[model samples]
Target: MNEAISLEAVSKVYGKGRGAVAALREVSVGLPEGGFTAIMGPSGSGKSTFLHCAAGLDRPSSGRVRLGGTDLAELSETKLTELRRERAGFVFQAFNLVSSLTVAQNITLPLRLAGKRADARRLAAIVERVGLTERTGHRPGQLSGGQQQRVAIARALIADPEVIFADEPTGALDTMTAREVLGLLRETVDALGQTIVMVTHDPVAASYADAVLFLADGRVVDTMTGPTAAGVADRMIRLGAWAK
Candidate 1:
């Protein structure tokens, strides 16, 4: 399979000399196209830093990160911004929706920002796919957490990006709602052949992924395929993520 994202000897450091902190150390991984992968680790384990580098949201201090065939390190800031806007999509724990805009408007915000018109047929399909057709006319404040997330998902899908990077996407929802949202994410990978890389702390949430990359001490320590919630929790325990 083609790689949607690849990192080679990527490292990130926050400061200089004695005051420096290393977030990622010689991290290298390739996320396969059309695959769903979850990144998990103890707090302070560099999960967020890894995601930012892989998605071109931040530059690695050394080594290379490639989105498809484009080398992120080679891009100018303006070029990187354009690449991110055109090729990548993001979903955050916080549903970063405009408060006053209706769901449809919010979903089409990216297109608007890019000075491109939203294709009506494609917008309708994305909204229906996310099961938010009925809520498109409503503002974010009027929707439940799950519905708001669905809108976020719809917005991510609108651009048909090569990959979607989601950070703790279901962290704000209740169990049942989180399940629904996760199921929707799974369906997108299965049905639409979407590539998703998500960072989640919850084992149940990680179970939705095809594989889990476990990070500890700024490096990938292990990987588990066909992960289950119990199995993932056990692995975390072994990693000392739950140590008292």
Candidate 2:
């Protein structure tokens, strides 16, 4: 299977000398193409740090991070930025859409930033796929939380990115809205064959993934395939016990 992202013994440290904190330690994992993988752990488990490093938003202090087989450490800063913009997509819990831009405009923003024009057909299809065809003229303020997230998802897809990194995507939404958004993400993996690495604290949200990776104290301690919410919850409880 093709690897959408690979990390080989990656580690991230913040600060210096005795005060330095290890956010991640000797972490290595690969996200296979066309898979939906969720990262979950208790607070301070380096879930966010892992996502940032894997997505090229943060550089590892040691080891290698490769996005679609390209080693990020080898690239210049400009090239790394370009690679992330063109090859990677990001979704955050905040649904970071421009308030003034219409839905259509927001969705196309990434392509514009990349100095590329959108294909009219593909753009329309993306809008339709995300169930926002009629709301293209509406601004983010006019949309519901779920609708806003759908816009974010469409924006991520505008570039046809090889990998998508979502950081607690449904964290801010209501239970119903979160479920809808998670369903859309799951569908993207099944229907569009998109590879997604989502970091979430919610067991229900993690259950939407094809597999779930568990982190504890800056290390990956376990992984579960075809995880159910109950199963993930049980594992999380065990991790909590270990922490205590």
Candidate 3:
């Protein structure tokens, strides 16, 4: 399978000299096209730093991050911004929706930002797929937490991006709501062949992923495939002890 995202000896450091901190240490990994990966680690384990560097939200101090075989280090700031806007999708824990816009507008925000219009059929299908058809005219304030997350997922999918990056997507929802949102994400990968890389801490949440990459002190220490919730919890227990 083609590599959707690849990190080659990537390292990220902040500050300088004795004050400098290395958040990622020559980390290297490849995410296959259409694969779903969950990144997990204990507090201060560099999980967030890894995601930020990998997604181009922050640059690596050294090495390379490639998306679709193009090195991010080689792109100009303008080109990188354009690439992210056109080629990637993001779902955040906060939902990041514009309070002034309706659901439909929010879902199509990316297309509009590019000075393009949404494709009617595709937009309709996405709305229906995410179960947001009846809520299109509603504002975020009027919706429940679960409904709002569904809108966020729809917005992520409307762009038809090569990959989706989710940061604690279910962190704000109730258990039932979280389950529904996770199910939708899984369906997106299994049915639509979408690639997703998520940063999460919940064992149940990680269980939904095809594989989990466990990080510690800015390095990948272990990987678990075909994960189950109980198995993930057991592994995380070991990681917590290592964090000491």
lDDT of residue 166 for candidate 2: 97
Candidate with best lDDT: 2
Q: Rate the local accuracy (lDDT) of all candidates.
A: 0.94, 0.95, 0.93
Across 1-244, the per-residue lDDT of candidate 2 in tens digits comes to: 9899999999999999999999999999999999999999988889999999999999999999999879999999999999988999999999999999999999999889988999999999999999999999999999999999999999999999999899999989999999999999999999999999999999999999999999998899999999999999999999988867
Model 1 lDDT per residue over 44-98, tens place: 9999999999999999999999999999999999999888888988899999999
Per-residue lDDT of 69-123 in model 3, one digit per residue for the tens?
A: 7899999988988888888998999999999999999999999998899999999
Q: What's the CA RMSD for each of the models?
A: 1.2, 0.7, 0.7
Ranking by lDDT: 2, 1, 3
| Residue clash pairs of candidate 2 | none
Error of 1 at 79 (Å): 1.1
Q: Candidate 3 overall Cα lDDT vs. reference?
A: 0.93
